[model samples]
Target: MSSAFEVRGGNRLKGEIIPQGAKNEALQIISAVMLTSEKVTIHNIPDIVDVNLLIELLGDAGVKVNRISRDKCEFQADDIDLAYLQGADFKKKSGRLRGSVMIAGPLLARFGKALIPKPGGDKIGRRRLDTHIIGFEKLGARFNYESDDNYFRLEAPGGLKGTYMLLDEPSVTGTANIVMAAVLAQGTTTIYNAACEPYLQQLCKMLNSMGARISGVGSNLLTIEGVTSLGGCQHTMLPDMIEIGSFIGLAAMTQSELTIKNAGVESLGIIPEKFRSLGIQLEIKGNDIYIPSQETYEIQTFLDGSILTIADHPWPGFTPDLLSIVLVVATQAKGSVMIHQKMFESRLFFVDKLIDMGAQIVLCDPHRAVVIGLGRQHPLRGITMSSPDIRAGVSLLIAALSAEGKSTIQNIDQIDRGYQYIDERLRNLGADIKRV
Candidate 1:
């Protein structure tokens, strides 16, 4: 059986907490290591289950992996065997996480062919692979999806030649994959409507350090002049912004004066501002976020004095990944807010669990939830619940920390995939939480 968290609520947590390395960036950067055979040294990597699984998958493909430290590692892809990639065992390993789909770009760029099984991850909504597959096809690669076995095959026998293409949406992983592939193509490639998240910028900068000619570092339009090969380079990942956001919400809901150190405030786009809209007071002391304890916070209204709605969009907008935490935070605020999860259809369904914990939440639809804050007037009663996904699992954990009694949360494997030693970290903050 999977481990669960037994949380004793109503604890006032204090002290500083450090956010881990970005899980999303680690996946993309580690896959890019296969683009070169040189020793690629990476620092500040999150020691999370997902990242470890990706590393094991790379090892299965015959890449030389060395764990230099807990937060540091090196990769050498000199002996990458194509036969291992085509085997059933490799497919099973790749299917364990969604990041496996990213291997297709580097594999195809270097070997002219790639194969992948159906990617597995949180079933929040219809996350279509069309963006990735179609983008690869637009760049002169032939892609075939074997529906019988749910596998994908991509090939470019004549070698990829860079071309200009416009993406339907700014998909983060899609842009990373295409950019990685285009860097090794024969000619220049211009990608419009590309994702420009800080993680992508970091990836592009790291690629440039590896001798890949990529321009437009922080914009929707990217230009890449194909290079012959990529050399190894050193990379340091930014702190996980989602984890920082979670910590901020945790401090607010539990009414604790907590500080998040080295939060990479510059890279956190619109996240601090989004939480501030919920009337959560924040002090930015250099790179640290200090949330002071408060009895209650009032949700802000629109300039027209209407109810404020929080929704997700592309980068520079509030991320859909944090909407569940935002919903839980609203439960204790002084007013109401409508959380519209525009990207994922099933994410808001987790609100039913919150409602059972004494939160006044209305599940308007699978995509929307209206939360009316109880203003700390009535404390939430702890209850046993099962975590559905990563973000929702953490949100429910936060709720349990501020509830009236002890609560049990199951399916903690979902939580471990993204967070590194979360229970231990919370314990250091004076929270009575344990992994059972």
Candidate 2:
């Protein structure tokens, strides 16, 4: 049987934990390693299943992968086996991860041909690839989809040329793909309404270090001047903002005085403010967030005295990934809040598990839920439940830690894909949780 977390609830956790490296950022950076043939030493990589799987995929494609430490790895893509990318085994491996779609851009830019199987990931909603495909096509690439095989073939035989494109949405992965491809195209490429998240900025900076011309970073508009080739450069990942937010929610829900160290506060756009609206008080000291034990937190209403509505948006807004944590924290606040998960339809479905655990929540629809805080007036009863996805898994873990009696969380692999040694970390903070 797969591993499960056996959690004994009602413990006030203390001590400090550092946020791990960004999982989403690591995926993009690792894929960009294929853009250069030189040795790329990346530091602060997260130790997680999803990232480890991507490293394995790269090795299968003949990229030299060396693990120097638990959090550092070097990759050299000098001898990429293009034949392996079209094989059945490669298709099977790539299909298991959504991040695999990103490989198409680097491969196409370097070799002018790339194949991708239908990618798989968290079934949050309809995560379309049209943005990535459209961006590639705008750069003068011809794309063909083999419906029967459920795979994609992208080619730029004459070589890609830079052009202008305004993405329909600011998709993070889409932006990374187009940027990587544009870095080697024949001319200057302009991208409007681009994703300017810190991750994208870091990736852009890293590429520029390897001789790519990119301007207007940290904004919606980006300009990339193509280079004939790219060289290897060392890159470090930022702290995972989603993980920091999750820890904040966990500390508040369990009434624990916990401190999260090296949280990279500057990159955390609007996340702390969003948590503050939920009545969760966090003291930011330098790069650390301190959450003191509180008897109760009262949710704040809008300036118009209307009920607070916490929703997700693109970067510079509350991230959809952390909405699950927001909703879980609202269940213990002194007032009610409506959580509107704008990006993913099925993400709010995890409220059912919290509702079963004595949380007063009304699932208005697939994307919205109203949580009425019980204010620690009532203790939640523990129950066995399976994890649904990465974010929801951590949210459920937080709920379990605050509930009464013992709780068992199965399918912990879902959590393992995003969080690194979460059970052991929680245990370090005085949580009565054990991996069974």
lDDT of 2 by residue, 1-436 (tens): 8999999999999999999999999999999999989999999999999999999999999999999998999999999999999888998889898889889999989999998767688867787899999998998889899998799899999899999999999999999999999999999999998998899999999999988999999999999999999998999999999999999999899999999999999999899998888888899999999999888889999999999999888888888999999999989899999999888889988888999999999999998999999998998889999899999999999999999999999999899999999998999999999999
TM-scores, one per candidate: 0.99, 0.99
Which stretches in model 2 have alpha-carbon errors above 4 Å?
none
Candidate 2 Cα lDDT to native: 0.93
* lDDT (10s digit) by residue, model 1, range 1-436: 9999999999999999999999999999999998998999999999999899999999989999999998999999999989989888887778878999888999989999999678698867777787788888877899888887789989999899999999998999999999989999999999999999988999999999999999998999999999999999999999999999999999999999999999999999999999999999999999999999987899999999999899998887788889999999999999999999998899987787888899999898898889999999998999999989899999999999999999999999999999999999999999999999
TM-score of candidate 1 against the unseen true structure: 0.99
What is the lDDT, from 0 to 100, of the residue 92 in candidate 1?
78
lDDT of 1 at 30: 91
Write down the RMSD of all candidates, one decimal each. 0.8, 0.9
Model 1, residue 129: displacement in angstroms? 0.8
